[model samples]
Target: MAYTKHIPKKRILCRELQFVLVLLLGWLAPHSLCAQRVSIGLYDTCSIQLLRVCPLSAGYKLLLNGKFVEVEKGTELNFSSRGRMLICERAGNEYEPCEHIALVHTDPNAQFELSLLRPQAETRTYDGNLSLFVDFGRIMCLNLVDQEAYIAGVALAEVGAKAKPELYKAQALLIRTYLMGNRAKHLEEGFNLCDQVHCQAYKGSASKYPYIRQATQQTAGMVVVDAEGNLITSVFHANCGGQTASARDVWMTETPYLQSVKDPYCRRSRGANWKKTVSLNDWKRFLQSKGVSTERINNTGYLYRSETREGMYELPGGIAVPFRDLREYFNLKSAWFNVAVDGGEVLLSGRGYGHGIGMCQEGAIRMAEEGKTAAEIINFYFRGARIVKQQ
Candidate 1:
């Protein structure tokens, strides 16, 4: 599947290179899906329509389940066995016979779409001619195995994984969610029979593909929870500005750390994306103003392992909170975490993106350049997570 597009390295009039990185994600079909056949309720049994089984209505189509029924448009569908298969089609469309349908949800051989986009972007709306989403490609490359090309996918699934532990409580929530959703013995057998992430993608349970096997191996027991001490099934975004909110608070509930951000990485990323990196002269002014040593600046533009965001404040517990979110959401207050850097240009030193988490995409690319598999790459970041054969 297609992912991101690299900007051409054309030499500008100056050596200061500037260009946007576009990120596009492609969805892969599930591996080894077990099929099911069941009858659908075209019309409620107690309804007036039930009295007439000669076909529901003039144009009302029936879907056995959610897949395509493949009955031609404006044509009368023929189905004698109501107990054999499902029937599904558009609400107002016609439903043909269930046997005509070959697949559901997606088709790998079908064509895809691409769009142009600018990063360090403003506004989330896309114009479509060629729109692109922005994300950190640095982390996805961290631990690869045998040179797999699923980098974009790694990024897509990972954004939610890395944010947890800090965002929610208890690792069991993730396990229960996945387990509850796919607990059939047939599904489990099918998992052992598949070869990609669309099935069981982790290391131990049923995944056999090396990279996905490896990812599953490493993060064997990680989950996120809410403030009320409940397990959360959904994941949300927009970097809670540092101090993550609980499900109730953010989504307007009282769940513990459910929908929250307990760190300052958001604004730092925002500052980097919104404002140019702090100027060396200005960085010093800001650091000196914050009681940090000017010597921390070194010959570089920023202090080593020091705060560089132009948009945060310390709260009652000495936590850093994002100031930009005061009005839209609750003011954030969380002592976020990150890797410590020594020295470099504020503009150049903090050049790459992301929270400097487990995997570094740019670093992964560099590792890939040096010859590392994505499996090995993922294992590097997720410490106790494992990669086991699910069978």
Candidate 2:
């Protein structure tokens, strides 16, 4: 079937067929081919079965004028679909239909596990403080008095630090309910109500029932920054295993994240999947890896650090260490360990997961039951931090 074998010498059979189908569909409903969110790993879980695809370059499937159609590789498309879109990945698939590719794979056992769940991954928090720091909607506006503002900031810190991602998201939505004309930027927009707690209310409930509706409403997003005033990529947490990290502790550098400890709301749980363990290796092994004077490992704990590429630190035995890599490594959950000795058998160790940070989920949830407000819980873990406002 050499119907179209001239152009794009690399077109596969599937893509070739797809192009023809889309052309026919376009003739009927010309306006459906305009938007395509390009090359995202698209998966449809709405029905938990069917998968529709718009490869951005290869193929496009659409239902135009009551007819199913597809546009093939290297060809333009025009069509529409009545079905709703579900999820698209931020990353593009390098290989079409890779080994792990699937329409939608449901996990039978998706129950939430505290030790396995990273709080940062939950995306929301509640510090028992008044204001919530919602991360959805790309619009966050809160205008409160000094005291309330302080409370809000403290609440954000405490909860953001201590709560998991889901909890943080829920808490942020809850706080938006009590907000008024919003922040100075938002104040520019006209509001139905003026200042004074008229718009916001103080709801009291553990289920967070009343406030949930308003808090979950869309809002602005917040950017995290480093000490250099450069935006710090966020490294969220629910618990730090009773100890949150100094920027130096995780990044091995002076980052603005180091100052994150100040947020009273930011604290980790006591139990962590990942724990720090002592590693005392002999000079023979350590120096051989360092490629430097063996005496350095014998005298002091100084390891060979790379001078060219910044943040690359070496241990006494010359194991390469990168700050960013360590940050990810130290906060892993359930990872495999393979130690390869020159002549000895490979030693394998399987360890629990997560970065050992504040308010371990299991520990915090337990504390929450013990009548600990988000503030009390955060303070207990993140030492010396005070709950304060953003101002």
RMSD vs true structure, all candidates = 19.5, 18.7
Q: What's the alpha carbon RMSD for model 1?
A: 19.5
Residue-level lDDT of model 2, residues 4-106, one tens digit each, is: 1122112122343234323321212312343210011001001122222222222233232334344343332111112222222222322211111111101
Instruction: After the best TM-score superposition of candidate 1, give how far the Cα of residue 370 lies from its true spot, in angstroms.
Output: 2.6
What lDDT does candidate 1 reach at residue 183? 32
Considering summed lDDT, which 10 consecutive residues are worst modelled in model 1?
Answer: 138-147
Q: Quote each prediction's TM-score.
A: 0.27, 0.30
Model 1, 60-103: lDDT tens per residue?
Answer: 22224234243232333222223323232334454543421221
Candidate 1 residues lying further than 4 Å off, grouped into runs, are: 1-356
| Candidate 1 Cα deviation (angstroms), residue 255 | 20
Clashes of each: 59, 58
Error of 2 at 218 (Å): 8.4
